[model samples]
Target: MVHSSDVCQCESFIRYEKTFGVTHFYSIEGVPRTGPTNVTILNITKHSALVKWTEIAAEDRLGFLQGYRISYTDSSRKKSPAVTLNASVTSYHLTGLKEKTTYRVQISGFTNAGEGPLTLSQPFSTPKYDKGELEGFVIGVCFSMTLILVFAPLTCCLVIKR
Candidate 1:
C-alpha cells in the first residue's frame, strides 16, 4: 500500500495500485506558469536608449529565460525591426539614428514558451542639433579677434620704429 504523504515532491502527482500486491507510483504533468512581467523603457538618447524592468514570474527555477524584444516607431510612423536581447540584459543600445527625431519604444519580456505584453513609453524626441547660424556667427567673431591680435602688435611696433 502507498500512503498519500509518501508521494515525492519531484513527482507532480503520483498514482498507486494494489492489484498485484505491489504498488507503483507514476508522475503527472504540471501546468506551466507565466513568464516575467512589468517591462518598461528607462531612458532614451540621440543614438541609444536604456530599458529597465522587473522579472515577476517564471515557469520553473531550472527553466531558462530566453530574452526580450524591443520595437520602435519613428516620427514618420514607420515601425522598425524588432531587436532581440538576452534574458539577463535589462538595457540595450540603439545606435545609428538621426538627431532630433521622435520615437516611440516598447519592450516585451520573453522566455522559451512565449513573450509578455509590450510596455510602451511616451512619445520622445532626440536631442536637437546645434544651431548652425549661431555657431557660424560665434566662429566668425573668434576669427576676427584672432586676426586683430595678430596684426595689432606688428602695427604698434611699426609705429614705434617710425
Candidate 2:
C-alpha cells in the first residue's frame, strides 16, 4: 500500500508490485484560478473616468467586489482622495474640478480575493475659458458698430438738409 507521505512532490504516481498484490496512487492538484477579466476604462472626461470590467470567475468563491478605487494627481503634484464606486455601478462623475488643470487617474477593482492592478488613463486637461480682455474687445467692437449704424443715417440727412 502507498502512503500519503510517500507521494512524489513532482505529482508522479508511485506503483508498488508484490508477488500477489499491486498498489496504485493518483496525484492531483487544484485547478488553476484566474481573477477578474476584461477590465477596461471608458467615458473619460476632464473630471472623471468610467471603468468597466467583466464578472468574477465562476470558480471564484470570493464575495462580490465591493467597488473600484480611483486615485489621481494633478499637474502640481497634488494627490486627491480615493474615489469609491459600488459593485453594480460601472460609471461615476467627479465634479468640482478645476478648469485648465491636468490630471492623471488610475483605477482598480476590489473584492475578498484582493485588489487588482491599477489601470491608468491618459492625462487630460479641463476646458479653459476665453481671456477676459478678448471678450471685452469683442463687446466694444459690437457696441461701436451699433452706434455707427444708428447715427450714420441721421448725419447724412442733416448734411443733405444743410
On lDDT, the candidate that comes out on top is: 1
lDDT of 1 by residue, 63-162 (tens): 3456777788889988889999887776667766667898887766665546766664546677654346558988999999999999999999999999
Candidate with best TM-score: 1
Tens digits of lDDT, candidate 2, 15-89: 542235444332322221333355554554544545455544534313345666667788898988988876666
* lDDT score for candidate 1 against the true structure: 0.62
TM-score of each: 0.53, 0.49
After TM-score superposition, what is the CA distance of residue 136 in candidate 1 from its true location, in Å? 11
lDDT of each: 0.62, 0.59
Q: Candidate 2 at residue 86, lDDT?
A: 62
- Clash pairs, candidate 1, are none
lDDT of 1 at 64: 43
Residue 37 of candidate 2: its Cα lDDT? 53
